[model samples]
Target: SQSSVDNMSCPSTPSTPTSPIPYEIQIATEDDRESILNFLQTFFFRDEPLNSYLGIITEETPRCLDLENFSLKELNNGVNLKAVYNGKIIGVSLNGILERGWLGKDDPYKHGDTKFGIILDLLERVARESDPFKKYPDCEKAMTVKILSVDGTYRGKGIAKALMAKTRELAKEHGCGFMSVDCTSHFTACALKNLGFELHYSLKYVDHKVNGEVVLNPAPPHVAVTVYTQKID
Candidate 1:
């Protein structure tokens, strides 16, 4: 259910006071695309050579995913996919409105639709393959957390926790009682768990072969465990 954004609007919330690092957490806009991409490039590719998949897209892809064109309506309505620090863009968390009967429908990944379709396909497969679905009470909810990331340089500095806090705030602001995330990294899963997020189920998929060897990538499934704390309450 993670939809795209078209245009981004600056957050109405007052910017938090500067700290030693002078970090600022705000809703991301299209203007922040370059920074976000740069952050991702550094964190997932440059710093962590093990995660080259994060930089799979070209320059054009970021524009398509920018908040200026795809999910403009949601952005205006206060659906926040934000960044942290002085435009360093250390983190991102995005969610989308859910449709009724979404779980019963066939996988939305067809042929075209590119980015959106790819994500839908990934989620569909993950859901079908994962087990222990009962723990994830929010699976049937009408919203999905599409992205959550932290820059490598900023990792271990509590930025991830801040990002989760903001994400919870956004969900509550939108009156969404449920949220979900598809985690592919151990760090992400740990962060979610530390924030009290519970595992609904996990899917291991053979996405592709690397270095002529097949690799099993375990995708962690998560759902909102609590309302006020955004933890697994």
Candidate 2:
């Protein structure tokens, strides 16, 4: 009987669960900032060096925590999912726009006709493989799916998929057609692929030694993956 319970899926529709182990998904508010940070800190450091990439520290200051709050606040342009069980925050999902020209325009190094041509070629290749290009606002105009994270305690319970389905639901409601995410973990990538995401491009980085010195360089370029799903049936 206990195994049967594990096989059951949460209610597909959005609402608070009524059972004893109740769970609810709702919009995250400013008051949830501390809980959000605590949840993020759990996963932010699992990969050692990569955690450094996020600029997170074990001794987080109140100001740093506030910055996390600010980032979430700005992402209000998209869907933010918070899963609450027993009146405590247990999981979260943040998805929003990845605007076109946002990347190329921000990097001053890629200016002028030559650099523009190279970057544009890359963008075109990305656009060709991404499903976002064919949907609502067009992939080049805006990105639908972006960030998804689930708490550690709740892993292996299908919570991630539930949150993703909720994201797709929100994207459909917003009149957006496609979604994409840059995933670093193989588990995350494989899960997205299972949900119909495809690989578009991938670039590896290597820290190496050259001529008795050390250097960091981009590894051979590879394909990037894109996960695409039509929010509407």
Candidate 3:
């Protein structure tokens, strides 16, 4: 496990995995910011419902910006990972630990470059209300998979799944009691379900309207925001 720790934030060109899909997992560092940002901007920077709902990446949508602020702090928290192949980052997972009373506190969301502060408020409220740890007693450790994204070219290769698998191992190594993932992508929800994470809470897109006007109608398949959790052993 110390090996993983040493690899944290280090850009070492290590040996590859034995699997047919050759990706090397390592903890990301500040030096990898540009690479990570560029990769995300090219793929997941504005790919989510919130961003898509506001057209954050388009040339005409002057109302918003990308979701870089979302995971930058998670990297500082030192639990993030990068999946690389051929010296290129193909996937990433931003992770953090949630302690007890994590909800009954000041919101950690930074509102700069956001499309709407209201959406953040609503998300925070719903996430707090849907706290899975609230149902249990003496549960103090839970690792939150804050963000998971993969390159479009590598979508069907289980990159996100492998990144999540590493999250579990990282959680277990850090003595976390469980792992939690907030899935706004329908495909990701299905992935978590296949990985045995139970859907702890869900809010359909139609239910998250603003001023009675639905803001997000993300293509097809991505119909809801789902929170999923799986206990770590």
Q: Evaluated with TM-score, which candidate comes out highest? A: 3
lDDT of 1: 0.48
lDDT of 3: 0.72
Q: How many angstroms is residue 210 displaced in model 3 relative to the true structure, after the best TM-score fit? A: 3.8
Query: Tens digit of lDDT per residue, candidate 1, span 1-233?
Result: 11101011212322553234657678776566566556555454332212223333446453334222332334433455665666456676655655435555653235334533443455455654442223445644334565566665655566667767776777666655555665655455556656666555443334333455434332222221111113222
Of 1 and 3, the candidate ranking higher by TM-score: 3
Q: CA shift at 137, candidate 3, in angstroms?
A: 2.9
Q: Which of candidates 2 and 3 is the stronger one according to TM-score?
A: 3
After superposition, the stretches of candidate 1 with alpha carbons farther than 4 Å from their true spots are 1-20, 45-77, 104-120, 128-142, 206-233
Q: Which has the higher lDDT value, candidate number 2 or candidate number 3?
A: 3
Give lDDT tens digits, candidate 2, residues 152-228: 66655666677778877776666554566654344455566566665444422232233443222312121122233
Runs in model 3 lying further than 4 Å from the true structure: 1-19, 60-66, 108-118
lDDT of 3 by residue, 161-191 (tens): 7889888898888878888888777666767
Under the 3 Å rule for N, CA and C atoms, how many clashes does model 2 have? Answer: 11
TM-score of each: 0.59, 0.59, 0.82
